[model samples]
Target: MTAPSRPPSDVSAGVGLAGLVGLFAWLAVCRAWPAIAFHLGLATPLEPLSGPTAALAAVLFSGLAMALWSVLVDKVHRRPSTGIDWTRPRPLDEVIDISITKIAGLWATWAVIGFAYCVARWYWQGQYVFAMEVLGAAMLPLFVLSVPYVLWLDRVLVDPRDGAWHFGAMLIGREACDPEQVRIHWRAWAVKGFFCAFMISILPPGWAELTRLDWAEVFASPFAMTHWLTELLFLVDVQIAMVGYLLTCKPLDAQIRSANPHLAGWVAALVCYPPFILMGPGSPLDYHYGTADWSVWLAGWPAPLLWLWGGVLVALTAVYAWATVAFGLRFSNLTWRGTLTNGPYRWTRHPAYLSKNLFWWLSTLPFLVTTHNVNDAVRNTAIMALVSAVYFWRAKTEEAHLLAEDPKYREYHAWMEQAPTLTRALGRLLGAARRRPALQPAE
Candidate 1:
């Protein structure tokens, strides 16, 4: 006979303890790398947050995160149910393994850079080994932590009796979570909740800015109206994207259809966020918004043409808004609900991504900015390109997973892949609409 299954408590404790070890291992190395290098004569001691202070901080931080997460798991596990169905199998280990694997790819990419730096520095007596050492130090910790972090996630998310993830469901005040209906992960909830809180937190200042905007001045300078318009549009879209899913979906428990599983795809998706997205070599994600070169190029044209540019921005923002409307109360990062065939989706596979990226390209405002160092500009350009590429990867990964699981996606994939773009998709839709003929005056 097969060995008996491990007890739930045992499994939970095992994963938690294992993750703690992984966290300790990585944090210890990150804290120790500089001193280790200095002792080995590979580089000088790092002055900023180095040595013992770094060690203490890393230990404290890791300990706190683990301790807090453990407490959260216990609380969540023991919390009373919210009455939704919880009969699905939760392949939590798979989620942990896949997510961690994807994150590791990020570590690998940096590891290469670290090694390249080491190789380059060897010629200069390894003096500037900071790049190599810092990244190199981070790799192992990140990789190791990924395992236990996932395990910890499993402990926190998966319920053996129900075999479903309820962290997200519980937060929405639901006693039970139905994966088939609405799935919420702890990570997504935290992010969505934080942003919603941020928007609410900034409301005072936002209102103050609105109050300060003079409509008279705005009418005299049509451009001035953009201040509030931008704010309004941003506020609406964010509120919907972040909070609507939790509040407005059918079932009253917004179910995230599915999340992406590919390692590279997920990392590419996540680095679009803070901290990691901000991780650049002396180049943070700090930039003011402005019009793109092409938009400025419109200035030499007629006044109508300039007005046309503003309309285009509005249209792009509308496309973004349309997507949220499509998602309604079911939106979450990196998850696929049913394929969208209506509204902007029929127009393009990834309307939001396309529109947002297009908006950014137009708003780069190249004409307004002076020429900068080629290297700096190129690096910035690469970062933007990487962001675009990540979204594209997300679209493909979503298609990959959905097509694998659903015949609906496969059919939709054939249709979307045939078009591969908005123009083509629109053309196809129009042709189909023409063939079907318009409804006669609603009878």
Candidate 2:
């Protein structure tokens, strides 16, 4: 009789097998099918390379159409107030609702349009291709269209009365509101929308390639050069995914949001937001709206993946843990338990916030789909660094607000007098140095 399998052993075996099957399936659907059909369709008369190529062709065309539509919408309909109108009484509630509706409508409308566009494009291409051709024709349009819709949605919606995310005065007189809470910025909405749309547009080719059989060759030659140049961008793709995960997954996100109730919205909004959507085996709406893509981990592991996987997870966790612990220490050691702490607390009462921003930057590492291209590496690194810097500024704003909020915080302000400018200088120097590795000695 065969020996009974231990739980851990069985789990490992199951996971590994699942990963292998997923990886191969993804490669076959994304890369192999497309290439084979493209070549075969080329050889067959009246077969217009119908599937993957046609789908790609549709995405390109539909993307252009969507971009144009955005510009046209900007010119024609032009929803006023930048989506989040702070001037409205109890604006937070109103803005939240409108934002939600806008996001949803934009996503749904564009998804449908995108799908239609791809099918039309494929039909026009008039080619015989593999099953992927039909699938791609059906899917690419939805994916492509989500970009612009997301942008427009952010521009049009603001404040719901009931504190739920909703649209304009359409649902007014339904809920009461307090004047005490702060409203979110409208510009932030536009910026976020643009970011989401841009992210959506950039993802398809690489992803579609990865989903097919000839995936390994995606970065093999001419594509390899492109991959290298945009490796950092590919990495940005990864960062986007990880950010989405951290925001959506309760175990990962709850810790951060536990600090403040308002942060719950931020965390939820960020996680499920449209920007991280990459085409694969899922609903485009799920992709465009907010949700986690478990399919990403379907493959067991990339060779040498342990370092990247473990390092990113560990670093992010450490950052958050340190923040929580530091906050605890600050509270426990303070002379007055309820009184505001001094030192780091004075200059920036929330070192945790600063650290949290840094964690976001670090956590993006494993998520970025790195390709073997110098350019890709540089681009992605630069983008993540830029985003990190932006977050740093955002953290500083939070610090400013915190300083203003607590009177006891004033006493700690004196520490800034003794604070070293060298730290910031050293940080920049170290960052630059680390970005470029030491030259390995010749063998």
Candidate 3:
């Protein structure tokens, strides 16, 4: 008779919970390898490696990051897992092994993309080191936040196995076993808290600018008018997205079904966030065209026509905001909430991406239209194209995930394809939103 299947590895087959923690740390390192290389002065901005000293320091930093992971796990583990639910609990060890392995595989898939990027750039020019640095730097936070953050998305007992149930539950407005389940609550709060704070911080200045807009000066000519409307649409877009965000499910009503657990998916989707790669600490790794820059495409139009073009741009952004409203409080950076089939969603599977990309094609100006330097224009255009490709990829991943959890999503998906804009579709969406059941958050 065949021997029982060999356990996956020394850790998965041997150690139990400790092995799971170690496995997570190891996968995290794989994700961060490029960044570590940079710190070692191994990437493009290479320097004299203070050989032994640098090695020692790198070892310490690696140890520290891992220690932080262990600390988080231990603290998260102290509570009774919310994953102990109405269903029969599966064997925790088996679940842990499977979850850890799957998540690790996802992170490794990101590394594969990094390697592919490196090869592409290297073949074009001898830029291996620079390419590695760019990919690694971007991948750093993506991997670090990935394992911990994704625990909220799990629908199975694996959430408890990883001690993520408490924080994950708390994040989606579920009743927590304790108020201070761990510092994860702080992390969760910091995420939404910072978003609100940033939105508020910008409003006063934005509103002031909008009011201060010189109407006569803006109407000087068609090009001038185009510029004014572009700025106006941007101001309005930001406000709507934030307002819709504030209206989303609060803890009292929100129930997170699953989070997007794939590492590449998180990275692909998050690269769209300004803080992730736009105006914040990690912004340097990405450069692309934003909606704000689109008005340049409307240059030379008559004032009336310019207004029309600007109206289209603003309308697309409104679709973005409406998707937020349709989806509701369950709306989040990476988690699954109830699927929305009405509002703009009734018109298209991905209204945000579709409208945003169409806006890009219209606005491919800035460097693309104005620059004489073909190399610079091409490179900039290519990067934005890559960014658009990432969003499309995120849409597919989201579809796959939703379909897995709810066969209803498949039926909904099919219906949208056949009769997405029918009056019946709108009626169904209206009814679903009205009738959607929400359980009370834990007492």
Q: What is the lDDT of candidate 2?
A: 0.35
lDDT of each: 0.48, 0.35, 0.48
Residue-wise lDDT of candidate 2 within 340-394, one digit each (tens)?
Answer: 3322333344454455545444434423443545555455556545545544554
Error of 3 at 71 (Å): 41
TM-score of each: 0.48, 0.28, 0.46
Question: Candidate 1: which stretches are off by over 4 Å?
Answer: 1-212, 248-250, 278-302, 366-369, 372-383, 418-443
Candidate 1 Cα deviation (angstroms), residue 235 = 2.0
lDDT of 3 at 377: 64
Roughly what TM-score does model 1 have, to 2 decimal places? 0.48
Each candidate's clash count: 12, 47, 5
Which regions in candidate 3 have their CA more than 4 angstroms from the true location?
A: 1-204, 214-237, 243-252, 278-298, 301-305, 366-369, 420-443
